[model samples]
Target: MRILQKYLKGGISSHRYKQYIICSLLALFMVGGVCGEYFTNCSSLQPGQYLCTEVNIDPRTQQPRGCTKEGWAKVLCTSAPGIICTETNNGTFEREIPCKYTNGYSYETALLLSVFLGMFGVDRIYLGYYAVGLAKFCTLGFLFLGQLIDIILIATQTVGPADGSHYVISYYGAGIEVIRMDNMTYRMPQEDWGVVGRGIKEL
Candidate 1:
């Protein structure tokens, strides 16, 4: 309290006061950055719980489609039909594969930040693109053109977290549907391989 009073009362030199303020702001920024990295609570989900990967939106109504009216689509784990599987707490059978992990980054947050602060490069910095952030900052978001481009990219989810993590959006929110490919969904064409081998033998 005494030190703060001294600074406030102008007991410290102006140069020292400015330095102190700058240092304080920098410290706060660093702490905020660290806290922001872990803003999501996806880790709290249990084994039986599921995460919504995508929400399909209707073109005409601009609302979510399928599943519940709130767009709560239950993710199902699939495997070979005959394979034994343990029933989850939700009364559904799921394979051993775990749900996708999230790193606390949010799609809505990124898009909003890009729309509002892209000119200052805050969006790129928040997404962990230090180099691009610095460039944007120096160029004023490339004279604002880069800012506009970033807005589109973020809205479409073309740019994501630096660690290659997916954005954590609300299950009820509108999002583009993504088809997930798994071992059961994909298989090598044995007939095609056999035909190629026969052709090689004839040659």
Candidate 2:
């Protein structure tokens, strides 16, 4: 308010006043962009979708302490007791049974980078492949052939982060569905041991 009053009172030059307005507008735009991205990426999780809120090591026991939407929950689909808890690259436990995890890597960002700056290997570098990124940069994406291949791979999600982490994508976006295996889903052979042995001998 004081700065604006000073500018209005002719204490500041008109040119400098215009510069201040432009800078303030630019700052506001940048802040808005950041907030929009945060809402879209971090806070848009759907109901029943688990997000790993935090993970840490217990000082006394040295055991991994993982907290998800369920609060200190380590396993998903506990009634089925199928998928066990697994640690992700981002120091969080994999909260979903199908192994959906986000290591701060965005599928859209990767695809866009591959489509636009792939020749410069920006996508590869962003995916954590420094060596391959350097090679692609030096060879100009292998004369653009590698770039094409990478674009397709990233589009289909065949290639992901170099640390073996999955990309963060929209909930309804393209993804691989893995069926969970549990006691009900799997059973031991019902055949008698003697009969199986006889059959094996005949074979």
Best by TM-score: 1
At residue 170, candidate 1 shows an lDDT of 57
List the global CA lDDT of all models. 0.65, 0.66
Candidate 2 TM-score to native: 0.43
Error of 1 at 169 (Å): 0.4
What would the per-residue lDDT of candidate 1 be over residues 61-177, giving only the tens digit for each residue?
333333332334334443222222334323234222222234667787899989999998999999999999999999999999999999999998888888765566654556555
**Cα RMSD (Å) per model?**
30.4, 27.7
Per-residue C-alpha lDDT of model 2 across residues 2-49, encoded as one tens digit per residue = 779999898999899889999998789766663222212212334444
lDDT of 1 at 42: 30
The CA lDDT at 110 in model 2 is 97
Q: lDDT at 102 for candidate 2?
A: 52
The TM-score, computed over Cα atoms with residue i paired to residue i, of candidate 1 is: 0.43
